[model samples]
Target: MKFLRPALLGLLSLAYPPLVYLGLGHFEPRWMALPLAGMAVVRAVATRERVWLAAAVGALALAASSMLGNHALPLKLYPVLVNTVLLAVFATSLAYPPSVIERLARLREPELPASGVTYTRRVTQVWCGFFVLNGGIALFTAIGASDETWALYNGLISYVLMGVLFAVEWVVRQQVRARHVHG
Candidate 1:
């Protein structure tokens, strides 16, 4: 189930933009919005977290507005919503102690040196910057671009960019670790 959860999420994320493009033109956005809103509500109720609660309310409002209206513009905010949430998560981690990347690094190298701690902090900042840039691009595409363009950027381009960032970071981390091991 642990693997299943991430797999399902990945599949759903990949399918979302194209589905939005198809549904918005020919079908109602409510078909997608309502279920997502319901899931948000369920998650909010289960977790009782402020973020989830806020998301639930926002989703419900979006679903209602989309259903009541003929235009699918409200539905087009999907990328903005997702990007904002991710940005918040990454940015907020930087504010609190042990940035998310540092926490992950500590799991692998429990005896992390001072240099490693500094490296992780810098990496975490880089990730926050990436999320900010990506989210800005997503918001811009969502608000002003055609659905096809939005789909291309959010679904394909963004993922490719993230892959590149992850690959680069992994390579750098390996070099840094080797330096620590030899130096």
Candidate 2:
């Protein structure tokens, strides 16, 4: 299901922080900042590959989270709630704007000539990435967490996957706009 991505992102974030405190690494948890940042960057760059890379990060994050097992259930469930809320918002906003793709036809720019399905997929991918990451973080947060910095590192990084997936939502919207002109 679509929820799977964010759920996994939640899981991936669980491992992030502990890795850093050990002096092993730090970028992992901070990487949680990426989704929103990626959205901003993609908007400026207008590069499909970058967006795709962000998406891939989301997917990997999601996949990585699965390794956490039940750890995700308690630690990072709020993001999942957030993802659902956003989905409801998106569904209400679109109201079938001609076609699913057309809904995404203009993430930031207008479509010269739009295709129904392609744009829809783009839009969907964007959302899929965001929700997965956000929801994942919430799920990670919900799980059992230790107070020490090391545990926090593992716990937070375990769910930082949201950074990438959340990036998906904004990135997709922006991408739809950028590609719209091309169509």
Candidate 3:
């Protein structure tokens, strides 16, 4: 029960591209922006995380700009904003200490070995690189591609890429663990 709301919100964000594609056919861009802004606000209030708060501000700004200009461009930029925020957060963790991947690894193994720390840092760097490439594609799709293309790439292709990355990382992690155990 405690996790349900956040989970649903996450699903909503995942569904955004297709929703925007469908909504643009029948509704104004300003109308479409409302749900995103509302969700961001709810997430910010619920989590009290700086990332969510920044997202809320960005969403609100998009809504305002869309309303004022009657343009869909702002709505299409949400994915870019999300990727930017994630990249910043992950990159910041790398610069400070205990990279984002290390933090998640800590949840499972509190006393992570030095090798595990190094592996997690590398993984975090990989994720940062992924974000940069993904965000670049997203920006191009948002600015230059048709609505269908944007929806297809952002809604389906991006998730598939992420899943593949996760699967590959898991496989590598298993190999690393096996070597650690035997070596």
Model 3 segments beyond 4 Å from truth? Answer: none
| lDDT of candidate 2 over 96-154, digit per residue (tens) | 54434344455633643545355565566566555555555444544544335325533
RMSD of each: 2.4, 14.3, 1.0
Overall local distance difference test of candidate 2: 0.45
Worst 10 residues of 2 by lDDT: 70-79
Better of 2 and 3 by lDDT: 3
lDDT of 3 by residue, 1-183 (tens): 889878988999999999999999999887888887787777777777777788878988987898888899999998998899899999999999989999999999999999999999999999999999999999999999999999999999999999999999999999999999899
The positional error of residue 157 in candidate 3, measured at the CA in angstroms, is 0.2
- lDDT (Cα, 0-100) at 14 in candidate 1: 68
- lDDT, candidates in the order shown: 0.74, 0.45, 0.92
The sequence of per-residue lDDT tens digits that candidate 1 reaches over residues 1-183 is 546644654576567777778767777766767655655555455555676567657756766777777456666666666666666765777888577788998998898888988898898889878878887888788788888898898878988999999999999989988988898
Clashes of each: 0, 53, 0
- Number of the predicted model whose lDDT against the real structure is largest: 3
Arranged by TM-score, best first: 3, 1, 2
